[model samples]
Target: MPLSEFGDAWPGGVPVQAHGMDADPFFAGEGDLGFARQVVESAERGELFLYPGDQHYFADPTLPSYDPDAATLLLSRTPAFLGVVS
Candidate 1:
């Protein structure tokens, strides 16, 4: 499929807590994303990565702990997970 993992393994009822987390700064469409982006960037020929980011999921762009840069740093190590020759 075009998108890996297909957003599975993410339990339900998480948005409730996330709902009150002030969506003002939680634009899910912006930024490189947290570990999810990192794992995606590390995709190899055959590998799967699934994770949930709702309860304590970091990378809230609006909050004081927005970590957009984490994606870039994680991208650097994706090759290893992908089994690339590097």
Candidate 2:
């Protein structure tokens, strides 16, 4: 769905967590950062945003693009996010 749909569906607000890397090849050619910024800007009251910066930071450990520290940080923070959203 489009980002506008998200804005329309949950007028109250929603917690959002976005993870991306500046050097990620997949996003390099696209406007991912711009889109993400829009989402963060449009976020409702109390919403959240999270982005880990590294080339393909969220990739699995088996992937060369994976960043251990970033992944660990994301893992540690995830539980808190779940709590907040819940």
Q: Using TM-score as the measure, which candidate wins?
A: 2
In the predicted model 2, the residue pairs found to clash are none
lDDT by residue (1-86, candidate 1, tens digit) is 22245554233432111111122234233432343343434443323232233322334556754445543444545766555886
Lowest-scoring 10 consecutive residues by lDDT in candidate 2?
A: 45-54
Estimate, for each residue in 5-83, the C-alpha lDDT of model 2 and write its tens digit. 5554334456666666665665543766656666655666333334445475465798877778777876777787678
Task: Flag regions of model 2 displaced more than 4 Å.
Answer: 1-11, 45-54, 84-86
Instruction: Compare the candidates by lDDT and give the number of the best one.
Output: 2
Candidate 2 scores a C-alpha RMSD against the true structure in Å of 4.0
In model 1, the Cα lDDT at residue 26 comes to 42
Q: Estimate each model's TM-score.
A: 0.23, 0.66
- Per candidate, the number of residue pairs that clash is 1, 0
TM-score, predicted candidate 1 vs. hidden true structure: 0.23
